[model samples]
Target: MQIIVFIKQTFDTEAKISLDASGKIDAKGIKYITNPYDEFAVEEALRIKERLGTGEVIVVSLGGDNVQEQLRQALAMGADEAILVASGEIKTLDEHIRAVILAAVAKKIGFDLIIGGNMAIDDGSAQVMTRVAERLDLPQVNQVTKLNLEKEKMECWREVDGNREILLTKLPCLVTTQKGINEPRYPSMKGIMQAKKKVIRKIKAAELELDLEQLNGDEVKSVWETIFLPAGRKQGKIIGGEFPATAFELVRILHEEAKVV
Candidate 1:
């Protein structure tokens, strides 16, 4: 089994977000980590390879050179190899272009199965894997929580509207991982040391022979006009009194002041 796990580097969940003077996310001082859901995908791929006793788990990502850190992390987690699709001179890449590049990479490097996170934590678009699947014309299952692989096909369970939907797809399919699939394992010291010696192959997006006109086109599926911080939450008011009086006051506040009732 040859598994390819598509990963992304995202802002750390706990990192503070702020906008620059140009009204864009300030990436200057922010910390980055492997997308949490992508970590699950990488771990699942490693597990599948281990279970089969003979297979390769390859982790791939697209971004600037900084993304190599996240790729190294995945490599340390037991992926047999890593590939970095350098964004090159492109400053802003929407999900469509990203998907096209990734799908091209998939074709360049064949795989038995492809996995990725359900959505990136930063943009939360959840479109890349779906678009890749569409471009590749392969069966795809999203938000998979349970997966069982066989010789010719894979059976998986995904949650939709609080209910689990079972799906069976043939080999060479793509799946986006969700929570509750498997706990990601931390990279051991030995794995970390070995990862230092592993060479990550870097491929420029231009080398993929994507349509240059499309790459430089102004048309995009979506655009972010501007971004700003959400309004801060208001402080809570506490009314102290006896039980009935407090309950009565609370109801009055809800009905009148808060107007929630």
Candidate 2:
């Protein structure tokens, strides 16, 4: 089976991000790393590869030209090779739906199992993998925590508010992973050295031949209606009246003066 792992490059957690005119962050000289959640997806794919013993694993991403750096990190960990949808232009989160275009590209490459992180660190939309699966029109599972290859299907466990959800999905499905699914292994010294020499082919977005018109324009907007912090309360008073009297006074103040119950 051929497995495709999707990875993303994102700014460090503590990055001092500043929005530009288009509401996109300036990435001119920022330090970046693989999306932490996607790393788990990569580790999961590597584990499956080791178990199956013989399968091709490929990592891919759509971003600026430098995105190949992130793909190399995947190669160092265990992926056989990588592809980058390099376009040298920054894309906003909403605009990232262009990944749908990549899905058609991946279809031509022959992938049996597709995996990606739960969300991009910067965007955190947790939407791409599911959309990619939709574009492919194959079965898809999102934010799975436990996954096991069973006799006839893939057993996936996802977290819910009060219980765990289990599902059995057929092959040729895309799975998006959260961090708890698997612990990504650190790259060995040998792997690190090899990564420096690994092959990373650049595939321009235009070459992918996706309909760019279908990839732009979003209607949702965060107006921020108001943007101030909440007000802190003043010091509290220890009342001297009887307990019942104090209770009555407290309720009165809370409702009449504070306008809160």
Candidate 3:
């Protein structure tokens, strides 16, 4: 089995977000980490390879050189190899462009299975993997919480509106992992040391034989018109008095002011 896992680097969930003068995220002093869901995808790929005892788990990512840190993290988690689709000089990469690059990489390398996070934490678009599946014309399952692999096919359980939908698909399919699939393992010290020696092959987007104009032009499906923080929440009100009086006042407030009644 040859499993290919797609991972992404995103800002740490706890990192404070602020916009610059130009209405873009201020990257300075912000920390980055592997997308939490992608960590699950990488761990699952490692587990599959370990169970099969005769397979390779390759981790692929697309971004600037800074993304190599996340790739190294995946490599430390036991992926056999790492590939970085360098987004050279392209400042704005929308989900469509990202899918184009990733699908192209996957096509070039070949795979028995492909896995990725249900959605990236930063954008939460959840469109890249699905688009890649469409481009590759392969069976795809998303929000998969459980998976069982066999010789010729895979059986998986996906979450659907609070229910689980069981699906069986042939090999060479793609899956986007959701939570509750498996707990990601932390990279061990030994693995960290070993990862230092692992090679991460970097391929520029131009080398993928894609039209540069199309990729930077119409391939971008969306653009960020503005970047700003959500409005701060209003302060809460407290009603203090006798129980019945407070209750009556609260009801009146809800009915007349808040209008939630």
Candidate 4:
């Protein structure tokens, strides 16, 4: 079995964020960490390789050079090798363009299974992995809570709206992991030392043979017209005096002032 896990670096969930002068996230001096969901995917891939007793787990990420830090963490966690698709321009590309690059990478290196987080936290798009699978013409199951890889097939339990669906998929399938699938393990000291010796293969986006103009052009499906913070909340109103008067005032406010009724 050859397992490939896609990891992403995102802003720490608890980090304070502020908008820049242009109304976009400032991102300066912010701490970055592995996307939480991708950690689960990495753990699951490691478990699958261990269970099989013979396989290589490779972790791949697309970003600038800074992403190599997160890829090294994946290597420390047990992935045999790491690949960083390094491109400064990649940081500005939308989900569709990123997916195209990932699909191209997938085509370059075939795999029996591909795993990724159900969604990235920063954007919460949850679309890139599925889109990569679509471009590669592979079956994909998102929000997978349970996975079992047998001799030549995979059985998975996917979480949908208030329900679970069992899916049996053939080899060369992709699955995006959701939370509660398994607890991700921290890199051990020994593993950390070993990771220091692992070499990360770096590739530029231009090497992927994509048209630079099209990737940066209007072919992107979505456009961000503007970005801004929600307006500050207003102060609460008080209906004073006796209980009956307060209740009547509340009703009036709901019916007339707030217009919620």
Which residue pairs show backbone clashes in model 2? none
Model 1 reaches what TM-score against the true structure?
0.90
lDDT of 2 by residue, 25-96 (tens): 676667898999989988999998888788888998877767877888888897888888765532433433
Decide which is better by lDDT, 1 or 2: 1
Candidate 4 has which clashing residue pairs, if any?
A: none
- TM-score (C-alpha, index-matched) for candidate 2: 0.78
Clashing pairs in 3: none
Instruction: State TM-scores per candidate.
Output: 0.90, 0.78, 0.92, 0.91
Steric clashes per prediction: 0, 0, 0, 0
lDDT per residue as tens, model 3, 1-261: 999999999999999999899888999999999999999999999888887888999999988889989999988888899999988756678888888899999999999999999999999999999999999999999999999988878998987887879999999899999999999999999999999998899888788888888877777888888777999998999999898999999999999999999
Q: Candidate 2 — worst ten consecutive residues by lDDT sum?
A: 219-228
lDDT per residue for candidate 4 within 165-260, as digits (tens), equals: 999999899999999999999999999999989889987778888776777776577777787777889899977899898999999999998999
User: What lDDT would candidate 1 get against the real structure?
Assistant: 0.91
For residues 1-261, write the lDDT of model 1, one tens digit per residue: 889999999999899999899998999889999999999999989888887898999999998889989999998888999999988756558898888889999999899999999999999999999999999999999999999988878998988887889999999999999999999999999999999899999998778877756675763566678899999999999899899999999999999999999
Model 1 RMSD vs true structure: 2.6
Off by over 4 Å in 2: 20-24, 89-96, 213-261
lDDT of 4 at 62: 91
Residue 178, model 1: lDDT of 97
